[model samples]
Target: MRKRIVRYLLALLGIGAIGAAVFLFMFIRPLPVEVARPAEAVPVQVFGLGTVEAHILSKIGFEVGAALVELNADHGDRVSQGDVLARLHNGEQQARVARAKAGVVNGEAAVKMAQAAVGKARAVLAQKKLTNERKQALLSRQTVSVESAEESQMEVDVAAAELAVAASDVDVAKAALEDARAQYQLETVLLDHHVLKAPYNAIVVERHKELGSVLAPGEALFTLVAPETVWALAYVDEARAGDIRVGQPAEVRLRSLPRQMFEGHVTRIAIESDRVSEERRVYIACDHCPDRFHLGEQAEVFIRTAALDKALLVPETAVEGFDGTKGVVWTVEDGDLRRREVTFGNRTLDSRLEITGDLPDGAQVVTTLHPGLREGRAAKVTEEAAP
Candidate 1:
């Protein structure tokens, strides 16, 4: 009786399994899927992570090392080019400059004296020549002794030599004057270096040294930025940077002001890329950024690369084997399921990929991925969105 009961139970279980299989094959054969066709007039954008930066930033200081005697500007101060920002101790440099001025004055006096000497020698030489000529005429007429004429000639020769020496002295004096003037100029330049001046129209961002602090050459006393040169720098993934071009519209959101968006445009694209991170550096010039700015502040950037008239977009999560340019995706063709490889183009900021390749006419691309999808299986659109 137990064996008979066991056989009956086994037969019942077998019938139930057969019924389940039949129901699954007949009713569940066609998979319902949500699909999206090509969309029109979609804006394409690429996302990047970056920071607020400036095109012109500077660390300004004195060229010569000295004690900082005065500070005329501090952080947040606005300065114009050639405005005195600070001053080093000018005592020693000033003394040197004064000494050079005295030397220049002395050199001028020497030059004048040498010129006077030259003129005197020339006058003496003229007189000697006159006397020598008169003696020569007297000797030719036998009115003077030959020895007297010879003596006159010797005197004239001596005067001529004196004139040459005086002329040489004049040259030496002029050269000395030039040297003195050059020395004075050099001293003046060094003295000027003791005073730090603004390089351009800038806003002082930082002050590194206090007054009376001694600093080394090229040591920064203040940080400066050209207010007009403020911009945003973005580091975009190289894979998505192929479509970025100069003058494209972009939007920037500073991390400090997360809720606000700043309008900007692409100003420059670096020819080189970050080697380790494989990112391209792009510069965006802000159109109406605030007067106050913080350098190196974190920011988000969205760059509009293209505007699509009609495009089939699939989320990056839906594509299989996506290599940035091409990927495989599911599609519904003739009410049947299929997997097709398609080429991709510009990516939107929300991480959607644009389909650029030829998809079959009247075929709907599966956007909502579902499990158990098989090729040649009957498919139906669960929900369709209006174009």
Candidate 2:
């Protein structure tokens, strides 16, 4: 009787355990899951990679070869318009100018000597005329021979020729003086050319030569960029080029200064795509660019091509697929988890997605999936943070 009673108790305990397991499986509630709802907001953004560039990039080079004597500017120096940048050796040019000036002086002296010779010739010609007259009188009275009068007349002609030669010398001396003066002017210009000045308000991007270095003609002495003409050359995909247009609003962010966002507008869009990259280039004129950005720095640009007011929006996380593919979202219907298909439009500036499918207005959709969330499963809805 004891053995039979123990067997009955063991059997009853096993049945009770099975019944408890069944009861727990049938009645126990699942963990509540957090959910989100799609809201309406405006979308505004076009993404592209950009590089910092200067609108006015210029190379500073010399027209004449010379040894660099002094360098007044260095790389990264901010200079004003007309500021002196460098100087080549001016001593030789100055010497040339001095020589030219001496030539001018000598020319002037020669001109004076030519004039004096002319005067002396004129006086001699006057004396010869007087002598010729006297000789003529003597010849007429047969007091002097005809040869003597003829010799006197020849002396006058000789003096007259000498005077003509002197006059020609004066003209030649005048021309020499003019030539000397022109040479002096040219040498002076070359001397001035030795001093390089800033052509405009710019920053020195590069210095090609140091002091005492010899530079050749047409060699770049420095590279400069206009201070206020910095721009961004953004490479945008050709597929999205149609949405971009000149004068569109844009925001630029540099990797160096991640905290700052520069406001700008689309200044230009390339008419043709790049042959190699097949990307369209866009130019952005930053309204307020920081001083730190250098040429060729990588940047991210977001162009605002179009905007819609009070558009229906959802979190980007809520978008399960893109490009009209299959998209799924969880919606709470009658307190039960329900999976629904959604169609989306362009992503907004705030990263909110635009939904286009048949979702009930003001219905809550699951932005983040929680553990144990399934169709027909009991779920609790909660608001997700706005991005």
Candidate 3:
């Protein structure tokens, strides 16, 4: 009785397996797929990942070293051109400037004294010339001795030498005045350096030093971002970058503002692509950027390269072997799958490829391929449910 029971159970399991096989074969015999249609006025877009950057982002510092004394601007502060941002210990610098001014005043007085000396020397030289002429006349008339006339000539020579010395002294004094003035200008410039000022309208992003902190030349005191120079730096795939051009319209979506969309335009395109990533760098300027922006923020950009009035549309999943501009797709004809070569046009944001070639309207395309599905294999067309 036990042997009979085991044989009965084995026979029932065999019958169930056969029925399951038949059910599966009937339901999954042919590949079922959806159809595609030609579309019109589809906007072609190229996608890229990018960063929010400032065209004039800078790490500003002093050219000369000093100790921090006062900070007029802090992080997030908006400053205008020539606005004081911070100050270094300027007491010493001020003292040097005052000393230079005093030197200039002293130099001016010296110049005046030299001018008076020159005038005195000229008057004395004229007097000596008159005396020498009178003595020579007296000698010719036999009224003066020869030795007296010779002595008069020597006195004239001595007077001329004194005049020359006085003129040289005037020139030397003038030069000293110029030197003092130059020193004054230099000292004033050095004093100005002690005060850190903004070069343009910008927003401060960082503050590195505090009061009494000693800073070195070229050490960054603050980081600034020019509000007018904010832009997006995007890296586009080399394959799709062929159509990208400057002045084209684009859309930007920043990571910080996820739900908001911004308008922009392409400003520049890098000719050289990244060798490792095979991406071209592109710069886009915002049309109406945010009042405030964070540097190096991640972004997504879509550049409108072209617009097509009419194009044959196919789901991106239905196409394979795409090399940016060209790809292949599987089309159905008379209940059999056939390989069709297609040239791709502008891709839509909805993952639809614009077919450029002459493809039939309302043709069935295979979106999901199975291992059993091959070229010339019979397929059943099924309509895709509308989203």
Candidate 4:
């Protein structure tokens, strides 16, 4: 009985060992993977993060300080140039304008009174001159006393002096009238300042000051943006920004509308790069952007730089030791894995690298870096797939 029990235990141990061997062979022997082939020349693109911005963004404010009385424009409201946007407590300004007008009227009356004084002085001087002439004539004929003639000449002199003073008064009155008119015009301009008007056709982004609020000079009342001037502002890395040029086609996707892609073209490229981040700002103008857009909305952009009819392409994951323009990739050679040094050209939006070097056509490249994969290792084309 002891020999039989030992034999049964040995048999069970052998069965367990066989099961473990089969399990390892089925599950852990060789890794099953997808293989990639050099694809036909595809379009290469540069990716960037961006935001919606307006070329004409304005912070609307009051030029002069006053108490806000009425707000004609609100957030999200559409406005046109010269549209009344807001109003301040302009009662005092109106009163001042009226007072200025009254002063102008009083100045006109003063000018008329000065003119009348000049006219009266002229008439009196003419009469005095006539008397002086008659007295001189009479004295020449010895018909009047010399004292009388001298008195007549003195009277004429006094009358002439009075007329000159009247003319000077008229000139002073005219100057005073000009000053009053100038004050009236200044007051009218100030009164207009109390009523703020929109400077351009725009959409109100924000209403900063509420009605009945006191505002200082240059205090922002509303933020406005020109809807037609909206565009995408993207930042591209300096390395990739070298090839970017104005008028390049781009695809933009807004965070708010993820599924929708907007078509655009490059409009501007900044000459100066960001010192800290090493990025350059690029502006793109959308062909048919949405009618409504939130300013500063996050966006993603892809700019197509080049398109090739036929070129060797490989998955970026299969590459190693990449140094910007060059990298090493694992290629299947005679069903064996081998590393090849390749110089890269434009990169695709889907992370595919364009190999410009003489890589054999229809060569199978590994899509991933798998462990135990090395040079001269036998590899079977398991899953031939393209992503």
Best by TM-score: 1
Give the residue spans of candidate 2 off by over 4 A: 1-45, 115-165, 308-387
* Model with the higher TM-score, candidate 1 or 2: 1
**Candidate 3 worst ten-residue window by lDDT:** 358-367
Model 3 TM-score, 2 decimals:
0.81
> Sort by lDDT, best first: what order?
1, 4, 3, 2
Pairwise lDDT winner, candidates 2 and 3: 3
lDDT of each: 0.90, 0.81, 0.85, 0.87
Cα TM-score per model: 0.94, 0.60, 0.81, 0.73
Clashes of each: 0, 0, 0, 0
Over 1-387, each residue of candidate 4 has an lDDT whose tens digit, in order, gives: 999999999999999999999876655455455676556657878888989998999987888898998889898999999999999888888999999999999999999999999999999999999999999999999999999999999999999999999999999999999999999999999999998999999899999988789999899889999888899999999988878889999999999999999999999998988999999999989998986798889999998888778766777777898887899887787767778887888777787777887566655667788776767766777876664
How many clashes (backbone atoms < 3 Å, residues ≥3 apart in a chain or on different chains) does model 4 have?
0
Per-residue lDDT, model 1, residue 197, is 87
lDDT of 3 by residue, 50-162 (tens): 89988898999987799998889888999999999888888888999999999999999999998898899889889988999999999999999999999999988988998
Query: After superposing candidate 4, which stretches have Cα over 4 Å from the reference?
Result: 1-41, 145-147, 309-345, 350-387
Candidate 1 per-residue lDDT, tens place, 14-61, comes to: 999999998787656788887876788999888889988888999988
Between candidates 1 and 2, the one scoring higher on lDDT is 1
Worst window of 10 by summed lDDT in candidate 4: 25-34
